[model samples]
Target: MHGLVNRCIEVFLRSTYGNALWQEVAAETDVHPDGFLTWGNSPDGVTRSIVIASARRLDKSAGELLEDVGAWLSRQEQIRRLLRFGGASFEEFVESLRELPGRVKLVIPDLELPGFAVLSDARGRYRIIAESHQSGLMRVMAGMLRGMADDYGSLVIISVARDRIEIDVVLPDYSGRRRFELSPMQVRP
Candidate 1:
């Protein structure tokens, strides 16, 4: 298992463990990158997912590092500001409808539950596909969100009651008509 994971990380990034990159990432998150703690509930639920992205000590101008720092800061706070820190509330997640490196502004679309959309460079026509929240579809929606969840992306909830019984918030930003059907499922205790 360790060899498989190490090989995978090496393929995507510059380094794996106990390197300068890992040290920097640990400093950014204020924890020891080499040691982590994970806890779960029952036998089927995971309460945490730890992703470690390490890079070689990137040799860049001070301006570049500052730019990266700014981007990270903005990303950390963006979801709340966009959602007004109100409305949909559950687990915290930020979906990147469209994102790329060094983009100053992000285009995000939200539709209240059981539905999602596509985003481009904010210069073309955007399309949305949706489904009304129905009782039988909860498990399917849950599975979709769970399966596609990225460390920094979002799960769209169509309604609070029926669509998303397993997530945190649902924001509506896309065009056209929408029907919020879910009635907000009670989170795990």
Candidate 2:
């Protein structure tokens, strides 16, 4: 698995739960307490072990924990910027999901994101199939969808199954959308 994936989990666990809990989970899983390198690769087993141990220690299901991680990830500036590049509105963003894997690949050649197939039914209903070697990714995607909905000021109901996610955009523009700038400012020395 890509180290960035594991590193996100590690950051989420530590920031949300505290460094002590992260260290405990790391110890239980035999992972280094300092955590994964953002650009390095680790065995998939290491990620699974960390997730299992953390979930067990927290007394939460792995799906629930990963969902939280996804939501947290959405708030990160870099991730939010990357996702916001999808479109200007919530609906447009969801439509752009079909191209997400390729977009991500362009930035990180070696990173493998889940392949997403988006199906639109009624006007505001979307069904997304997320395929990856890792388990519980659908839940994470579901959480991300929810977070993005809020970010775009849309009201949505999201449901997750083993490999699929359903999103019902109750209100496409329910509130004020968060601000997003296309370009970052250059810092002068």
lDDT of each candidate versus the true structure:
0.30, 0.87
Considering every candidate listed, which one attains the maximal TM-score?
2
Please report how far candidate 1 places residue 129 from its true position, in Å: 10
- Identify the leading candidate in terms of lDDT: 2
| Residue 105, candidate 1: C-alpha displacement in angstroms | 29
Instruction: For candidate 1, write residues 22-102 as lDDT tens digits.
Output: 456556645445533321111111100113223224554322332233233233333224332222322222234222211
Instruction: Flag regions of model 1 displaced more than 4 Å.
Output: 1-18, 35-115, 119-189
Name the lDDT value of residue 126 in candidate 1.
28
For candidate 1, the per-residue lDDT at 131 reads 48
Put down candidate 2 lDDT per residue, 45-65, tens digits, no spaces.
Answer: 888889888988999998998
After superposition, the stretches of candidate 2 with alpha carbons farther than 4 Å from their true spots are: 132-135, 186-189
